[model samples]
Structure formats: structure tokens, C-alpha cells
Target: MEISTCTEKMVQIIANSTLEKSLKKTLKEVGVSGYTLFDVRGDGDSGDQSGHLEGDSNILMMVVVPLKTSQNLMEALNGYLKKGHHLMVFSVDAEVLTPSKFG
Candidate 1:
């Protein structure tokens, strides 16, 4: 059995419908059918916001898959990130206690 995990951070202009669409397309291309996304707020070198930056939001997506699938996902994401779009991708070792949950 093989296991792996990857996380991708994407920043989309506020109210941009294409963000979700792009994510779905990328996920499908990478062979990752399942993922979870959460809304997040933060301050970076760019500046600080009193509360949620205006016209900007962050989406964090996490996917856990078998080693082979994870590699494919990362390759697809590389092209996206190279466009200089506001995004980040990272991966690390992971262990799934219940394999059925991923299936």
C-alpha cells in the first residue's frame, strides 16, 4: 500500500466564479476526486486587514491519495502555479488509518 498527501492554496479575486471551476478542472486532471476547502483570513507582507481583506479571500484545499495519484496532481498544479497566479502548493508524508474513508 502507498499513501501521500498534498495541500494547495489558491487566492481568487473576490466573487470570481472561475476559481471554483478552475479548481474542479485541476482536481479532475490530477485524478483527485475528493477534497475539502475552507475559508481563511490572514495578514501577509502585502498588508493587514481589519477583518477579512476586502475583495480578496483564501481557499485551502487538502487531498490525500495514493502515491501515484498525488504525483499526478502535483504536476498539474505546477503549470497553474507557474502562471504567477496567487497560489501555493505543498506536500508531506501522511498516513491514513481508515483506507475506506479515502475510497
Candidate 2:
């Protein structure tokens, strides 16, 4: 059983709603339906405030998927992220305790 994990963060953007929709679409396209999201606030790599000064919101999302589905989802998100979207993405190997959770 192969597993993959992904962590993504978006900064200074009101793209939560759009991001959620895009994520869902990508997940469905890749046959994945499970994910988790959290609200986050922090400074960026340049030591700039992450929207705190401008009263914006930041969100972090994590997704775990079977290896077979990970590539496809990544491909879909790549284009979305390239459109000047302020975001970061990283992936790692993972093990799922509850296999049924993905279903």
C-alpha cells in the first residue's frame, strides 16, 4: 500500500473559497475525497507580516492520498499555483492508520 502526504499554504489571499473549490475539483478528478484544512497566521520568508497588517486571512491545507492518486492531483494544482497565486506546496511519504478513512 503506497501513501502520500501533501501540505500547502496560501498567503495574503482571499482565495480560500476558490482554493477549496479548486482543491475539491482536483481531488475529484484524481478520485480523492479526503482532506483537512486549518487557519494559519505567520510571517513570510521575507519577514513580512502575513496579512496581519492588512487584515487578511491565511489558510493551510493538508491532504493524504494513495500514491496512485497523488500525481494527478499534483498536476492539477501545479497550474493553479502558477497563476501568480501566493502559495507553497510540499509532499512526503505517509502511512494511514484507518484505511477506510480515505473511502
Candidate 3:
């Protein structure tokens, strides 16, 4: 048996839940093939997001994409931050199996 794998980037964005619809639209426009969004709670400059209220909560959006696509995605996300949207975005190197699935 053989295992096939490739390197990519796992981009993670933590932002206000109120931006879910807009964020999803951005992801699609940025050409992200797939992603995962989770209701999450955390403390930050904006204080604690308890996840008890949809509008006041936070969401963690994660996506694994090819290196080139990652750059485009980052640029799109940065646009949100520039607009003063409450968002935290970062990316880490990832070793992904079946990389085409992420492309």
C-alpha cells in the first residue's frame, strides 16, 4: 500500500458570528473548496464570547487549501480586518492527504 500526501496551508479565522453569511460568501468568492465553521467561545480584546447568543458569539472557520490559493484567501480575509471587522486570521503549514480534495 502507498500513501499519497502533499503540503498545504490550514487557514483559521476566528470572527464574530454575526459575520457568518458574509464570511461564507467571501470564502466562496475566494475559491475555497471546502471549510469547517464551529461555534466557539473565547476571550479577546472584545471580551468573552460566551457562545450563548448567536449574534454575540464567535465562530472558527478553518480551511485547507493549496499554497497559491492560500495567499488569495489571506488577501480576501485581510480585507475584512481592514474594514474593522472583528476577525483574527492565521495560517499554518499542513501536510494533507489527498490534497486534490482541498484544491
Candidate 4:
């Protein structure tokens, strides 16, 4: 058996469910090929996110991309923060298989 791994950046964003549509659009605009999304619940400085209500829930979006693309993604997400939206965004080093799929 043979395997290969490539260096990539994993971008994770946690935001309100109401922004799902806009967020998905932003991802495509930033050249992200795909992403994983989950309806998540947690407690943080913003308090408890129970994810039990329609528009009051939270979502976790995770995408892997090239380092440069990751920077672009963060810059785009920053626009939301500037507009007073509550979003938690960050990126980390990642090793991924079939890296071509993530660009």
C-alpha cells in the first residue's frame, strides 16, 4: 500500500445558523472547493448555544485549503466581524490526503 499527505490549512468558523447562506456564498467566492458543516451547540463567552431554536442555533464550518487560500478566506470572514456579526474564525496546519480536492 502507498499513501501520500500534503500540507494544508484547516479553516474553522463558528457562527450563527442564520448566516449559513451568506457564509456558503463567501466560501465559494474565496475559492474553497468544499467544506463540512455541522449544527453545533456549546458554551462560550457568547453564552450557551443550545442549537434548539430556528434562528438562534449555531453552526460549525470547516474547510481545508492551500495556505494562501486560507489567508483569503480569513480576510473575507473578517468582513463579517467588522459588520458586528458574531463569528469565531481560525486556521491551523493540517495534513490531508488528495489535497487537490480541497483547493
Best by lDDT: 4
TM-score of 4: 0.92
Query: Mind giving the per-residue lDDT tens digits that candidate 2 earns over 28-88?
Result: 7867666677766666653443555543555666777766566666676677768866556
What is the per-residue lDDT of model 1 for residues 6-82, given as tens digits with 9 covering 90 to 100? 43322222212236568777887767767777665566643442334544665567777766776777777767668
Ranking by TM-score: 4, 3, 1, 2
lDDT of 3 by residue, 1-103 (tens): 9898888899999999989999899989878878998999988799989988767799999999888888998999889889989788889999888675645
Minimal lDDT window, size 10, model 4: 94-103
TM match of model 3 to true structure? 0.91
lDDT (C-alpha, whole model) for all candidates: 0.57, 0.57, 0.88, 0.92
**1-103 in candidate 4: lDDT tens per residue?**
9898899999999999999999999999999988999999998988889977776699999998999899999999999999999999989999888775644
User: Total clashing residue pairs per candidate?
Assistant: 0, 0, 0, 0
lDDT for residue 28 in candidate 2, whole number 0-100: 72
**TM-score head-to-head 1 vs 3, winner:** 3
- Model 1 has an lDDT value of 0.57
Q: Answer with 2 or 3, whichever has the higher TM-score.
A: 3
The collision pairs in model 3 are none
**Candidate 4 global lDDT:** 0.92
